[model samples]
Target: MEQDNRTAYFYLFGDNEDFGMKSCWIRNLTKAPEEIEVKLMEKGIPPMLTKEFCKFPEGQESLNKKNLEIVWMEEGDGAALLENGEILCVIPSWGGDRGFCGYARDCNGQGGFAWELSEDNEIRKRINNAISFIKEWNEEVNPFQSLQPQILDYYEDIFGESEKYYAIDNSDWPPKGLYVYEGTEKIVFATVAVSLRPQPKVEMYYEDASKVNRIELGIILKSGLTNDEINNIASLISGITAIPWDYITFVAEGHTVEFETIASEKFKYAVLTNKLKLLPEMNVPAFGNSHTNFLWIVPVSDKEWKMMKESGSKVILDKLDTIGEEIFSLERQEVV
Candidate 1:
């Protein structure tokens, strides 16, 4: 097999002010020559560790006393440096506490792998190297794949422009909207449709003058339904239950629409009667006036609604509560 001859550079900085060993360079010469040796040079001290330097063991009391500034070794690359006129030495082999480590540094005579010098040029070089590594890793591991333009085109037709909308990763719900890099910039299309279905406020009222066991369930739909459609829906619901048509009222899109006449022939008709034939499996009814062309009303049991209200858990309810409070304050001239 052919040997890999790629080389990487690591920039090191020193602490000595008088000697000014502030900047130094380490060139990985693993594949260059077998006799290539590692050298550490200081102004006063003699050259230390002049032999073929490959790796060194941990806890070398001699080198520890010298207090090296930077050390990096990985695979076929290795180098070490020191400042303060200290003579640093090392053996040739790849094993120790710092074995196979890529980058290691010291600050104020402290030995560790963390790089803390933000103002130094060496630290900047290391940051650039890290950014390059991240970019390369992203390219190899999480490559940007362009979404099918046709799918985006369809959404663009319905929702207007593609750029105006944001992509959401619905794999996790409540459907997290992806960041620009993770979605739009990366060519990942937004797959979820946005629509307005204002939360329904539940109110209970007496069904009859007698005020017995029967109670009328009034749901105020703040938006997304026409008066006629609400009347038809109310009539249909009345037919299913023993509750009279007069008991049902739908506050559709800010206007109150009540189903008053149960016996009258004029109020018995359903515009979406044929449409309602496809029940249970296909309950979502689309109104032409809807901005999104569809209205989704998820039916929840009274027990579930009560539980959700008690816990303050439903996100839609929370949003609606905030909006209602703001609107109420504005209506009363409390907030200008």
Candidate 2:
């Protein structure tokens, strides 16, 4: 037999209705769709979509049906069973080219939206899956439609009506909207779309990775700060939301970020914390999977950051509390 190097590598993230979102490489299924031949298996398929198969698993991921077993055909080709546990008859994808792509099955909507994008009006005959799964998405098939509203609702439920909701579509349609909630003494700003995907090495953060794999960042500001200060905070929150995806790492409690020679030079660094003194009710998880953890960004000075690294964020928190230092204020006194 000749060497067949074609292999579809995939990684599953976030389960919805027992269906998972998957990312794959080896071929771009969106630009070129291919179906695999059916093959009956004597046994069931193992969990193929894992972090092990997808090291440094970056983008190229999307929604996928979960727990369905697969049967492999000759020459690196495979077939995924539908919810009914039957294989759909399909053509041989490995014949023409010896490469891989995203996984999809005609039944149960195994593949995410990207595979569906390729099944345009012209190639309807070649594809068997229905596009009904994308009803929540916009006409352009935006995936964030279903996820963003949950965060919006969460903020509204806890913080009441936002005086001004600032969102940008530059990166994603709901590019981490900063919901501005006004209070008599303090102001709150919570980000909306940061948890659309899981973080890298999130498993190390908690035993239940699903519960802690995702996060939403927030910062409460003291009342009477200048408009420019508030806007600077908004810009900072929006930028921080992209850090995980942009850097492929997870931000959790105790994580600290230092600002460069940026505009908001009042506070040089920040520490991630969950102890929201203003809105005690806002510290809960915001999603069905319990994946949305809220981390408050408490800014610190250079000396304070050095002290925090030496003693820890908890000690810093205690030191700040002892001095009656207001953590929500950008112009607050340094505790170092």
Candidate 3:
């Protein structure tokens, strides 16, 4: 048997950032293909990726409907099952050449306005809601409507000639400040950074048995400076910034390090949402936006945890009521 090389199946939800005011139309891209088949031997059906498949141990009986599994050992050809028992195999065809692409009818009454652009980042937060609304309206859309001319007209206005070097088309109307990279299997959609300035650099570190990469931010005042003078400086910084002084610590380490304040976890969110406008890795696991710096706190063994608490180095401090071990961050701006 000739070997086939294809990636395992992965589901797509569609892209919103690529389309603008009509961004709501993004959700129509999620429906399964009318006919999906793998090439080569052409008879073996693919499996479904359900919750059971992700949970069950790997093997053949694990290939049951409850644990729909697809193996990548053979590459190229793969299969998948629809909820209603329809089997979609890997086959060769024009549409199958570049994987799959299908048109969906707009079921909504808003003049096929299944997808619409949102006012702000509100759409990103309510993506699931948007998908549900569009699915309900897909049945009404006319997939056969001639959109090529309209798409051409939109691009001609921007690039003077819509044939090539154009930014967008009718098939995929990306929103401003969004990028879309569609693949044969999965699609990746991301919101581009809005800042004219370049993105900042970030470094990550995980502590093991002997060393600590986390640094504590401490502010120092001159020895001659009165307590009132120190307090005034502290108040000024706190007011201008979201960093809380209570979260900060004052340590007199000779003249080199005078006053220190531990930056809080809340400031992390504020910096990313208001300043950067991009997601960071550490906070990606959580749904909300990320701050200027990305930091994840992994707990050490209980023995180390107790020793650190008594070390008096102020290695671990809790500002956001983060009960277990904690992590803090600092921003790294480009030098222009």
Top candidate, metric TM-score: 2
Worst lDDT run of 10 residues, candidate 2, spans 88-97
**Candidate 3, residue 280: lDDT:** 22
* Ordering by lDDT: 2, 1, 3
Evaluate model 3: give its lDDT.
Answer: 0.23
Model 2 Cα lDDT, one tens digit per residue, 239-264? 77766655545688888986432434
Q: Tens digit of lDDT per residue, candidate 1, span 1-336?
A: 001122222332223232112122122223322432234223422221112332321112222324344332111122344334221211111212242222222221211211222234343443343234335425633211212243345444533463423333224212212111112211211222221111111112323311122121222222334445434444443332221211222222111122333322232211111111112121111111222222112232233344445653353233333443222111111110
Return model 3's CA RMSD, one decimal: 22.8
**Which sections of candidate 2 miss by over 4 Å?**
1-143, 146-150, 173-175, 259-266, 276-285, 323-325
Task: Estimate the Cα RMSD of every predicted model relative to the unseen true structure.
Answer: 25.2, 13.5, 22.8
Superposed on all Cα atoms, model 1 deviates from the true structure by an RMSD in Å of 25.2
lDDT per residue as tens, model 3, 271-324? 111111121222111111222122212212333344444662233222212431
Residue-pair clashes per prediction, in order, are: 1, 2, 45
When 2 and 3 are scored with lDDT, the better candidate is 2
TM-score of 2: 0.56
Q: Which lDDT value does model 3 have at 218?
A: 17
